[model samples]
Target: MKLQVVLVLCAAFALSLQAPSSQECWCELQSEEKAFPHAKLSMVERNVSDCNRNVTPKKTLELESLVLGLDRRIALLHRDISVLEKEDDGELYGVLSLYVVENEMVEIQQMMDKLNRTMKGDQHLTADVTQQLTELQAEMGEMETFDTMELVKGRLATQLLKKDLDNCRKSLNATVPPTQPPQGTCPHGQLVNVTGPQVFTGGEYPGSYLYGAWGRDPEPEPGKENWYWLVMMTVSNRYSNYVRLYSSLSALIVGKSVPGNIIIHSSNPTTNTIQGPNNVLYRGALYYNCYNQLDVCRFNLTTNTVSSFELPKGTRYNSKGNFCNLDECYPYTDLDLATDESGVWVTYTTNQDFGNLVLSKVEEGEPPRLGQTWHTAVYKQALTNTFMACGVLYGTRFVSKDVEEIFYALDTVTGKERFNVGIFMNKMAPNIQALNYSPVDRMLHAYSNSNMVSYKVWFE
Candidate 1:
């Protein structure tokens, strides 16, 4: 009905453009420069009684039906794109992206064929219908090229990631033990459960810097055991070149008395600088994803030195695979750096794993390197956030605006997983952007929205 109305208006406007009957007098309204396919407007003539009539041209009604068919096809095409957009398993225009696009193209061709058949031998086709058909043919010509280039790139990424997956499997001749630390290193018993936010602090920059990570170092390098570190994305909420060090929890909350500041030289993304919000301060060094690359960079605050090692090939980075719930995704969170009672670890996903979180130990060495890597069945983007506790990789998803639940866990020792862990985490803010646990305080620190929240963990 709406389409018919639109067609009526256009037909009336077009008809009124004809030369006025010299004998007729018609009312006039505002004129000149109307919208769409028309450069100017003029007074249109219509019988005063035509406004009250319910009559419409048969040709306009026919055009309405044809346009309505096109509308339905356009709607279906939009829904197909939405399905490709909303998946957390991986990125759009990835593995299945090209296939979906190609299928739509085929459907479009079928629509064109049917339209051509219907118009055959109909020499009196309206100009509007002819215009729409010409546009469709032009668009189809452009789409044929899209089907080839993107598919080639997608296949290349898959092949590279497959090689990396094979390398990861070969490196793990033995299981990566649950405990990477030495005997009695973690006096805290196994992390059995986590409680709600015990303390919520909105530092000076509350709500100003949305994407960031803050927590205590489970193991300190020397005299910085009591210090708290914060690293927030400064450039586009995706890149940072410095970290703010607070002496105590109170100092962090106050946002003042911050004398400790470690700056990573060369903020340029192509250099050795911070890239994502998934960074953690561990043993006087900050571990984070390096800028514009697939490498984990370790910046030692005490020594003021930087070391980095490349991540597995085809590992998603640069906002490709991020921490996301159904509603939204935290940008540049492709590589998550975390610390547990056992040791520091990094979690990410690749094409090979189909977006499942992959855990690799960030071993402390002269030139920091990746140690044993373990794979989990939990999809990386499916969950809101993840953390390592006592060699167990735990993932959380949104239960509510103020609540997040740890529903997935993978034990590195036995290579076993549990998907039914019912521990729930309540927060002061709506989203948990970054989460890490500190063995020293036995508290889970989270960067929520623009606030810092801590939760107490209970061990069985």
Candidate 2:
């Protein structure tokens, strides 16, 4: 019988060494690092890139719905906690209820943290969505529940999320996506605005009137004074069809459409003019406004070929009338591209962003893309023109012709705005539309009425 029992025990041990006969297994309960199927992490990363580039209304609505639900739930929980604390009667049951409240608060905080992470850096938020986020942040700030909240002082997570949301929305809304705006032709007639003042060629200003200039100040040279100028002649009451180019020292046209000639025939051909008169000459190409959109026409000096790069959407570019802020309304010269020590930068406003200025570093290619961006508190409509000098963005407002001033300057390094530049403009041309600064000589160039003038800027 003992021998039989030993044999039975050996048989059972042999069975255990083999695969389990029962369906239930301990291996199934073990955790897996990658629980998701079909390369979910990679797919999520791609989706984030796509969302940044362009946002669909459906996706926007879905996110908004989620945020709204979380907001409502948080509010309700906060109210319940407030009531529980108020009705406390110092009993054991009351203390136990408080413990339960604390547990609920912890759970709610976790959900909030997850929701905030999802929505914070998303670029799909619209003006309405932004308003909702602001309200949610305010509510979170008012609630005091966890020790971490007090240790950090206020709702730090909410504040960071607010900032991320604001920047993402601003940068995303700043441009018409590469896929959206029409190609081959401009959608909004002319690209530039002509309401400021008509450029006069012969009436009071008699010489070859300079509308724009780019490059260094003219120095005494034998034959190679390479500075360029855009000379204009007023043709009719509402339009000018001919624009000339000349070397500042040689007075020879540098732009040629014909094989041997020095002029390129260009016309607005529509009621809308260039978005902003401010233009930049980098390397050997000239970058200027193409249409009401943020698209910039690049005119090559060597090949005389004109190609366009679509820029980010601008504020009030499609507005039927003017943009009105808290102060006064002004015509939208909605997009401005300038050059400084670092490289090129574009400044514009978006209607959905409450007319705030969005500044971005311009990366060049077949189609341009915006790089690091800084959103400013100053309204684009408030400034007549903006330019970058020595890696700083300076905005000018035309109080009057004689009262043009550097109202605001943004430091790109620190992303801070300063109002105390103290440099003032005296006797500025009437209705000046563009202002650009040259780092070569530290002179500010002004384009007004079809006349270009340079001013000496002294830094004390």
Candidate 3:
């Protein structure tokens, strides 16, 4: 009898020794899988047998312990899942890491499903499982469109993050009370103050320019006002070999370059010109329309980050056709992206709209995005270029090269239009290809046939 009792006690001791430690049972992800393209199976610490924990009857110690284990395990599981969520540059098997997260999400979803089935009848267990299920469902939904890059991929990602945080907030609101405050908060947009028919007979800029000699002082934040950027290409026949930026129009004579190069992609940086008259400068980035105006690109001067967003569907890019007035079409000027007090704006006519100018807010983000859109009664084909200022959109027609600025303004605020603004270009080429107004110094910068001209505005 004594020997049998001793044998039974030893058996119980051995079983207790075989149980898993908390770290091992929590199924944390291994260090090796921390890199991109992590496999679904390798992410969790446990294998199939360990993951399929046996269930026990209600009111029993085993059942209570099982529920506690699941709760703790899920808490740890979230930490492992977050490793995949916080990065944008990670890829798996040449695919975005978002897919890897999706795969692992499915695995956890299955585990949650299994637990729900095992604890089906109990009210206490069901509530806990349902809450986790709600969270998992929300997270899974976010990953579905995780790679979508319309407008701005970063903005959409931010929205998803906001949604996730809101869901958590709702849960917290249900349990914990409120703590009051937290804050926070394009296109050839509009044209303004058209002055000038003055002529710079001297070599204002020395390039047989291929259509681009645009200039703007950096935006008027505390330190950036004194610096100006003027872009020009030396060769005009095909594309320029070099796209140069000078401190000012006169600064071009001295031949000084900006500190770092503005690397152009989507087209030949050295060869292809930025494709519109209405490129803009905001914050530290230069926003331009490219790919024949089918796309809008943002180049960050400070970070050197270049991101591009496609224009609306059925918009004419490539300037295969011209942006024409009733009399003639201007070559290579179909899409207009400009900046003003608001930020950035884009002007393009879509085939769906039957070539009517559709103006939209070009917002800044990972790639930039389209915001509120306003359609104009004016036919886009009738305008050569468009710009934005204050809360208005100003459009230009292709008058003769010798003519100064002839423009019309559309108040986006009131949905009103004013014709014959009578802005003129002086000391510049009669064939003005680009025009932008800077709110910073309140000057109009014009790019005409490879020449850079700056005019001070007397806004009436």
Candidate 4:
């Protein structure tokens, strides 16, 4: 019995000895187990220690970089905001400003990504790092709110600026110079300025001159007030069909006359002719259309050289399917040319049963090209019409058509017709042969067989 009890005691002692110390057993169990039961606690302890040892320095460096990046972004945002504030409504500045906010969002997301990667590496750091990340997310959300507010503010400000600009334009347009009586004392029988005959003189009419026409001078020369230059188209009236060019100061005609300077002459007589001289000054160059050959030419007064370009061969000049010809049977006459800050535009008529309006753009670059060609719907009611005018290009609401004897404020770019002034129909009796705009006076001048009249135009 004594031996058995001793044996049992010894066995108990041996079993106890075989077992590890508490800390040792804990470590051993961790090694033996498929998964450590105290894995989270172990990670927590190690992370705590590492945090104490390295987090301060690492966080300091990270914050420095983050702050630097944020400062740069903030500065950029401020600059963009300033720009947005100054631009008109619908200006791309606002969109560009929004890009700054987007960049910030991207940066924040990248920071979050980095934070997430850091958290993944250390399980114990997850909660604390997640909390910090959440705080950053909240800050980002606040930034988003700020961004949205700024965008709204910028949009509102831009709208207001545009409105102000428009109002100023209208006010300026509505302003007119005080009216004055007709110049020069009148004799009894006929109106003093009414009975002048068409005159032509020397070194003037080149033999090549075919069709010569002129527009009313809106703002006349200072001393020779009521004077405007006439744009003359002269083709080799005899043979070769080669065309030449001329212009005349309306007040200075001596005989059946023409102007000097071969502004544009045809090189390939078989293929081209100076079609129509719709004289226009654009970007410091004089541009006109050559009707017969479907070409446009630019004469640089400064350079004393002419550069020519052609339109798409298939462009519909007038609705009548009259592509390019000078004969009356063709149903269209290429008449008017105008330009704005953006580019040059030309207007021509189609000889179809119903008169059609054709508008085209001149392209840019080393050598210019013809761009989009568009045509207006048939104006069957306005038949026998021979004149049209583009008074303003941008921020303006007016175009002049002679048939209705009205000034229509139409969106020439978009072809949206606006208000029309119907007061001038009675004045249309004699027919307005030429229409022109004077930038100096901001007026539309109409030339009839007998007289030249001016109308004030307003724009916004």
Highest TM-score among the candidates is held by which one?
1
Q: What C-alpha lDDT does candidate 3 achieve relative to the native structure?
A: 0.58
What's the lDDT of the predicted structure labeled candidate 4?
0.44
- Residue range 1-460, candidate 4, lDDT tens digits: 9999999999999998999757653333344324323554455556556546654544544444454444445555566667767878685667877777678768766866675665564555556766755665565454445443387668889999999999999998895743421211111211101111122232234333343334333323344243344444333321122222223343334322233343334453333333443345554455655445556666654466667786554433422332221222212234456643234666554454244555566675556776766555534223223222332221111123222334333344456643343323323223433344554444554443324344443331
Per-residue CA lDDT of model 3 for 14-72, tens digit only, reads 98799865665446666532333225324332332322342222224334444544554
Candidate ranking under TM-score, highest first, comes to 1, 3, 2, 4
Instruction: Give TM per candidate.
Output: 0.59, 0.46, 0.51, 0.37
lDDT of 2 by residue, 177-284 (tens): 563222112232211111111122222243444333333422213442355444232433122222334444234222331222222335553322333345666655
- In angstroms, the error of model 3 at 206 is 2.2
Q: Model 4, which residues run further than 4 Å from truth?
A: 1-228, 234-263, 266-273, 316-332, 340-343, 348-356, 372-375, 380-404, 407-409, 412-415, 418-429, 446-460
Put down candidate 1 lDDT per residue, 283-315, tens digits, no spaces: 778999988889998888878888989998999
Give residue 153's error in model 2 in angstroms: 58
Instruction: Point out the worst 10-residue segment of candidate 3 by lDDT.
Output: 180-189
RMSD of each: 30.9, 25.6, 30.4, 28.3
- Best-to-worst order by lDDT is 1, 3, 2, 4
Give the CA lDDT, 0 to 100, for residue 117 in model 4: 60
Q: Each candidate's lDDT (Cα)?
A: 0.77, 0.54, 0.58, 0.44
